[model samples]
Target chain A: MTIRYPNGKLYTPHTSVQKTEKKSKSKDLSFSNRGKTLEDEINEANDYYIKRRLAIIHKKPVPVQIVKVEYPSRSAAVIREAYFRTPSTTDYNGVWNGHYIDFDAKETASKTSFPLKNIHEHQMTHMQQVTEQNGVAFIIVRFSAFERYFIVPYEVLQKAWQAMENGNRKSIPFSTIEEEAYEIPTSYYPRIDYLPIIQQLIVEKCCGFESEEK
Target chain B: MTIRYPNGKLYTPHTSVQKTEKKSKSKDLSFSNRGKTLEDEINEANDYYIKRRLAIIHKKPVPVQIVKVEYPSRSAAVIREAYFRTPSTTDYNGVWNGHYIDFDAKETASKTSFPLKNIHEHQMTHMQQVTEQNGVAFIIVRFSAFERYFIVPYEVLQKAWQAMENGNRKSIPFSTIEEEAYEIPTSYYPRIDYLPIIQQLIVEKCCGFESEEK
Candidate 1:
């Protein structure tokens, strides 16, 4: 079955994976059976965090430019014509323990690498600005084939992005991702539980432990 | 001329003020002749901040629920039918020096009081949650009659909202606002320079000087 987003974009789930496959190298692939989009899981996790007072994060509403509308009554208004606008920033951002958190989530069907094309230039600039302001900035990437999730820090993404801009590799290899990114262990209640990684990042940023570790 | 918002709400600018009025008690009223909406000024201010590396703030896109859409071409998607969704959070939020800043901008024609009807319940709740998480939350209110702007902290808004909930007062009096809120002076480049007040807030939050001053 094919799904269509609100903006009329086609969403074909697991088009690269064979339906008859019964075995996988990683145990995480077993959880892929749920067939939920990475966005869905992240939103669920955010809700869980909000409920527990652990964090306050939210996915921004998709940007749309409304050109025409009809008001049937004082209380009801219907948009008759509209177009999706290219977002100026990332998909998700909010406050987490007085620390500004900003990130974008993306999923790749590729099993070996995550393409740089998945991110936009404006998003990179926005993340850069966020980091410069001492905000926690990162990207949550999901490798759909293996049902693996990783929290890629903004610095790592910037390095890879700069390399790509310099006519280097167009994508970051899975091996490099595993080495530089922190893997998010999947669970039930909060499907993606990525805040602990953010906490670690805050600690590292505050103590300058990242350079020391390097 | 009548202006309708994207959601089809009528925005009658300065409806209560007479066009022939040449005198006002406050000097700020003179700037109102520029005829820009509060939202516009705020956006302009944000752009100025972003350009100068002062702060990063953005107004969230209007929430729209797309019911039907048509793909005219692979590159163009047209939304044919949609409805506005009540936003679950404030209109503006972003990072300013590692502190999460969240706020809603509102304009009122009344010179006496700011009606509680201008705000939504969910927005109040969202601001409460943001404040509870140690984020800086506030509201920017513009009194069109006087062309006066005030930055009312979340605590002040909460108090007013709670009073309304208890059936005490349905609105916050202008006097109360003048007493509790910080007035934003109009400017040329940024138009509405409100960040200086935010800096003061951060100082108070960090050093508890607010209580000391009180």
Candidate 2:
């Protein structure tokens, strides 16, 4: 049997480990590196930002609900039974440049459209609430097949999500995302570098710079 | 044998359980309620605030480093070996009323002073960074023995922490805390009700009302 770890790595029982390894290899066949995912890139970027004192963004630890525990020694307690919990908010949030930044990083394998199922309803609801509170909220979408990353603002995401709910399309077409999202060009030290894009969005939103930028 | 859970609950092993049960009873001799702790009170307060859309604060999950896993079925995977990890940031953080809120909730059994050991160095460093970023950072200290809670601003906490680092008193004297911290009166729906105190502090900090308040 194959089990997926919370970090998205697959673990296989020793009996059929080879089979599981083959599946994981195939899953990573398209990307540049097998172990690195969009989440990893963003985490590295956050580390870079923190090192330079640019931001304090962090990925919230995965929540778990424990049902049973065992005491092996005086100082050691082991969780015997537990289950992963649904997060109440987006994966990442913090303060950057005296502004609240909240966002989630998601990657899709599809070449043409990003599946709506990739994002949960509760996450979208959280983004909406954060934005309503005057916080900067967005989604970092990576089309893994194309090796492209885009920062889609909460407004754009809301439009796309509502369109899906209204039975317009099940997935956000890649063309729509390309048109509406800001392409975050890759960098070396800070791999994802989404903060500048976030700042730009905030400036435009606050100053009504659509016409000025045009 | 008995084990203490992360939330401070005692877990007696099933073997020789009768003997272990007696110990737990004796340990709960002082508190008003054996089941409810300060963390529970703060969590309830956060829930109340969230439901009313007043704030979006959340406690970060306890971090655990998984060392081993077992797969009994296709979908069920159990962590067989894991250890608790030291958190890099304070537990609770979010956006509230167009401001970034970052804080940690700590309870001390001592009636006179809060031991510096109650908070980790990394957590205090994280709070310092948050404050430097213009985010509101504070700590909610509960003297559990007296059933008292106070909202201590980062400035107050920093002074105590630095004093300890400079070979001064190892604890923040209760008198000092009582003088510097805002006493948070308990409530029904929101048991800890610390956000109002946070707002007041922010108002004072921004408007330079320290002298006016005195």
Candidate 3:
């Protein structure tokens, strides 16, 4: 019978036990990610900044499978069969100047209310851990209608998530968000001028909040 | 022909067409991990520290194959034929106190030099990236001979890795390590007295560093 390896390679299963079909629910990420999903832009900006010693940030690569690889020699290896692997956290994380930066970029269709279901349990759990460690753990909430961005702390997200778990709100109120979050201004060069908000957050939330930019 | 999926599940080949496994000459990890190695201890320790909130650290769970899973219900799924996936980074990362922490732990029977071969290119790349972000990245090098532990920073590791790459040294110089690394004093509570080194790092390295400990 035709079988598949974990890397999505087609294989003929031989003398093995039987199991079920392969149909796992894939996360439905919108392909029309608004002008370079926040991840790509952040990575690019991180690259740009790090080279100049302005700041260092990085988006972790999408995890992948390497099945049926060819080691031409001890030094070189080629992947013959491979597949995409799911990530538990939103991509971007690294250091900004000196602050430990941890965040996820999410897109939402709704104009007024952002859906709590859009964020996964795993990402939330990961964010919680990041925050406990004194990292700048936040989410870049993109409300497409407003064409705006807000840097929402994980603590706020957790409270919002807990509220949802308690069936208090299926969505975080934009008013509450407006009050708590710093509105990120968009720009042409970096696309997301999050550093300004980050500066604000450093001033307000980060320990010994000081502006090194000036 | 009793064909099975990688998950060792039974499958029926499609009648219309067939896809064959793309072949390769590389070694299979499943075969290598068969002997019940102690490689999992670091992963376990990371989990323990994370759960206790003593530190916000974790070993990224190795990815796996889920060719066939039984969903007794829509909410629950049981994996049948899964194999451990390779990881890009060393087994641990998180926040200690208020500092970003990243590390890999390795043990060697060698009395003197720990082989650089234990650290992979991918792991080095991960360390490099973390360092760029100003994160305190390092490795927990364990000399099983005297049962000693040392927290070697990424800078030291990078230099050692380069030397190994240049074939100048097969392993890091023990003297260089003794001079630079913070020897992890053993303890009864956490087993690794990591806080002292962290304290040193904060005083010496982190920008706008704060004394957060009680």
Mark the 10 consecutive residues where model 1 chain B has the least summed lDDT.
B18-27
Give residue B200's error in model 1 in angstroms: 0.9
- Winner on TM-score (2 vs 3): 2
The fraction of correct interface contacts reproduced by each prediction comes to 0.84, 0.51, 0.32
Candidate 3 local lDDT, A86-186, one digit each (tens): 67665666565456677888766465666888788889987877777777888887665565668888878888899888879888888877777677755
The models' CA-based lDDT, in order, is 0.83, 0.77, 0.63
**DockQ of all candidate complexes:** 0.70, 0.41, 0.16
In terms of lDDT, the poorest run of 10 residues in model 2 chain A is A13-22
Q: Which digits, one per residue and each the tens of the lDDT, describe model 2 over residues B1-214?
A: 2445557776442322222222322433343333355667778788888878888888999887776777887787777676677899999998886688999988776767988897899988899888888899988987766667899888888899889889998898999888888889764446578888888888888887774433
Per-residue CA lDDT of model 1 for A1-214, tens digit only, reads 3545456776444435532123332234345436556777888899998898888899999999999999996667999999999999999999988999999998777778999999999999999999988888899998878677899999999999999989999999999998888888665546677999889878887987873333
lDDT of 3 at A151: 86
Q: List the residue pairs that clash in candidate 3.
A: A10-B21, A13-B3, A13-B4, A18-B9, A18-B10, A19-B9, A19-B10, B7-B81
Give TM per candidate.
0.84, 0.83, 0.63
Q: What is the TM-score of chain A alone in each candidate?
A: 0.82, 0.81, 0.72
Give the poorly placed runs of model 3, Cα more than 4 Å off. A1-35, A61-90, A207-214, B1-39, B60-91, B106-110, B115-134, B144-148, B158-170, B184-214
Which sequence of candidate numbers ranks them by DockQ, best first?
1, 2, 3
Cα deviation of B8, candidate 1, in Å: 39
How well does candidate 3 match the true structure in TM-score terms? 0.63
Give candidate 1 regions above 4 Å deviation: A1-33, A73-75, A210-214, B1-33, B211-214
Q: How far does residue B168 in candidate 3 sit from its true spot (Å)?
A: 5.4
